[model samples]
Target: MLLTQADIDGAVGDLSGVMRRTPMIASRTLSERIGCDVWLKCENLQRTGSFKPRGAYLRISRLTPEERVRGVVAASAGNHAQGVAWSATQLGITARVYMPTGAALPKIAATKAYGAEVVLEGTTVDEALVAARRYAEETGAVLIHPFDHLDIVAGQATVGVEILEQLPDVDAIVVPLGGGGLLAGILAAVKPRRPDVTVVGVQAAEAAAWPRSLAQGHPIAVTAMNTIADGIAVARPGDIPFAHVSRFVDAVVTVNEESLSTALLLMLERAKLVVEPAGVAGVAAIMSGAVDLSGRVCVVASGGNIDPLLLSHVSTHGLTAAGRFLTVSATVSDRPGGLIALLELLRDLGTNVVDVVHSRVANGLELDEVAVTVSVETRGPEHQREVCGALSEAGFLRE
Candidate 1:
């Protein structure tokens, strides 16, 4: 069924007390960088750490009493699993979530913590989906698709309603696109009201499918999908959402892995918001110039359910990308004070040493030589260059 403005209005009314009207905060840093008044729709702070519940709850709530009694099953890498689980618990129904074997540990734990039976199967979400479907067929359970139904689209449209109410002057909206439910919903709700406002969708370059699907004039499956943005790493576009995208979305873009990491770090460090890689795709698009950033722009911070270990790795990668961290290996004399002297040089150069390792008896080391690997924090690229220059001038040959 095609979703209309009236359907979205009904959804907004139905979801009044069920969902949180997440904050829309102004971002001065992003505004200055993009030369526009930037606002962040902070769905990352929503219940279950994503906007998934907005659609999940609305879909499950509309289920007949018999369907609810049979319980619900869903497949997700993280966010959607939590949404379905939380919604099922709220409605006094049983929930079973199928997750990929390699899904983030924290997400799996959180899904189970939310009172759902967690099943770990396959290596990707598509694979887990197979298991979920088989279980639904065998047990007569209702399968709740992540983003392919009319009700789901209408539920997600409420986010668009909130955006317009919160920022009526918003000229552009950038959102992370996976199966296109969120983008489709926003377009259905916002386009009719403000035809001049632009709606853009972003995807990870490594896992993008919409561009190819649009070119083919139908949903096309991506053969190989790999990216750090697992939450949005969908291989196929949902038919229901693709219809709305083709009709209303202004443009779609992709951001590289480096930009995704940098954007996540920027939100964490500069915006003081903990956002996942997928959640920050809109921000990445803006920072990388993938989207037109004119007039009052709103970028959706879609989710924040990130694993701590992955966060640590992304943080280090972000630091490297921003030129705030450096690693150098140099050969030095095997003398006792050789390492100390090199460290003193770094200290004199005002570089903060993060880690250091020294070794001898290596392929490039002479009998009286040792290789010292130093990891240091610098102010920026220029500061790193200065430290390297000082080390080279002090007779520490970089290896």
Candidate 2:
């Protein structure tokens, strides 16, 4: 049976005090870009740096006394593991988490800090889940299946409840889809009373599974996953959440890897928010024009736990994709004044030089010619074109 409004209310009560009422603030930047009044449901600031704890806390708190005694076991690449660990810690229950060997070190350390014993195994979350299941069976511990149980759905639905309370006239809600717990929960909670509100789900293009699953009327596992949005890079939609998605979600769309990086950059630079690639999927959808939304729109910024190294790399990629950073390779005179002349030209054009690579050792290069690659930062797309035109005009363009 589909979750009722009462189920959502129950979750709200269960989450009282324990859950952080994350902000729902207006965004002028996104509003102008999307041609709608935009609001952000910043679950990135939620405890555990994600919306995972909402469901995790409620699910673990509702455990039977016997189950609580046996503790809980969970498998996750990042967010879910921290959620279960934190929830179990609060309720004085033992928790064991199985994380992929490739899981980020910060996330693994965070899970361990939450008082859960973490076991690293295999290469992906799917493999870690197998280990978690076996451990649960062997130890008789309750397994916390992320996004697959109704109780978890109920918990995630609270996000919808909060949105309506915050933005009663909201016309559309864009959410990130992985196993579909967040989207399903929001749909269940929002659709009952506000059936007019259009709900859309966004996924990383490489890891998307919902579109096929909804089309087939069943959960279909995506065979391959290569995305920086690893938190939402789920291989398959969960059966329970898939039912809700099939019945309720208006549309499921995807954003490419470049779009994900750009969205993260947008959040960092424009919104002053640090969001993970998975969390920013909704924003990426809007930025990529994957979803045509208007009126008052709300996008859930889902999580903020990202590796610093990955953040640095994605930041550079985002800059390049947005045309805010440019690399120009040009062959300049080997004499001392040639490189200086190019630098002066860039300076006069008001571009900030990122770096310069001067090399005289290419196979076809004349002894008097030095090939130099100059990287500079531009304002945007228009500025990028201006910079390129100026270089080509100055006889420094390399093909």
Candidate 3:
């Protein structure tokens, strides 16, 4: 479908009363670090804790009354399911959603709470999508696509319009690309208004299928892989979205898991925002040095539907990546004063003890010795190395 400026403007007008005009907040820390003015489009704080509701609500609102009465069906990993369910509820329409069994519990609960009939059908989104399609055909329900549809694309385009208004001099925008709706919409709206503004897309390195798909000029199914950024863990790119992405998107970069965790942590600690892994992928790309931003930049934090457990893990991972957490094992004598002496040595190096595990028989140490695992929190790698050196000098054989 041809996505013109008129089409985008009309969609924005139709949904203006329903959708939010989310704020565009500046990130001084990021701007100073990257040598560019950086703004964070915090869509993670949107109505459904994601930007999906913008497209979902617009799509459902535009449907005919008969279609709404027939109900809507959709398949999503998490965020889209919540968006569709919430949007359907707003339109007073019955919604049936199929989600992978492995989808985050918080997301499942949120979707169900939004008044949709949630179905746990498969282990992967692809499997759930197949079931959703079959159910839609059998029940004659209007199938609302998560990202591929023209209406959905137009709906998401409103974000670009908001960004333009918020930061007219925005030199570039970096978006997290999954099924490509967000990227496509932003590109459609931004490129037309400011043709020179660079539009970049980011994807989880482990689940990056768009690069290969774009190279082949078709939507290719990336193997459904596990990633912390479940929101953008799409196996395939949308056909309609792909068209716009190819035309206007300046660059598509991939960031690793470490980068994602670090970015999320930074958002929580420095930016005072709770961003999910997917929401932070744009910043992850920036931190990973995958994209060059020499001018004003916008990083779209797409969602904040992170699981509590996952957040804990991401936090720990971030600390570890930043060298604030360290784990090392050493062999010490079995005598009574040996463990205390080792502790004293660590204290001398100014390393704070966080956790310690003493193993005697299980670690296969000699009968006269034991393996002691120490987990310490230090200032950084230099402090950690200094502590390790102190241990070694104290005659603790480290592994």
Q: Rate the local accuracy (lDDT) of all candidates.
A: 0.93, 0.93, 0.90
Model 2, 1-399: lDDT tens per residue?
Answer: 478778888999999999999999788999998798999999999999999999999999999999999999999999999999999999999999999898999999999999999999978788888999999989999999988998999999999999999999999999999998999999999988999999999999999888888888898898889999989989989888988889988999999999999999999988999999999999999988999998999999999999999999999999999999999888889997999999999999989998999898966788899888889999999998998899899988867
| Separate clash counts for every candidate | 0, 0, 0
Q: What TM-score does candidate 3 reach?
A: 0.97
lDDT of 3: 0.90
**lDDT tens readout by residue for model 1, 37-103:** 9999999999999999999999999999999999999999999999999999999999999999999
- Off by more than 4 A, model 3: 362-364
Quote the positional error of residue 76 for candidate 1 in Å. 0.3
- Residue lDDT tens for model 3, 1-399: 659878898888988778778889999989887788999998988898999998999899888988988999999989999999999998899999999988999999999999999999988777888898999899989899988898899989999999999998889999999999999999998897799998899999988989998888888998767789888888888889999998888889999999999899889989999999999999998887899887889899999999999999999999888778888888888998989988888787777888999988755678999888888888887887787777777778654
Ranking by lDDT: 1, 2, 3
- Could you tell me how far off, in angstroms, the CA of residue 236 lies in candidate 3 after the best superposition? 0.8
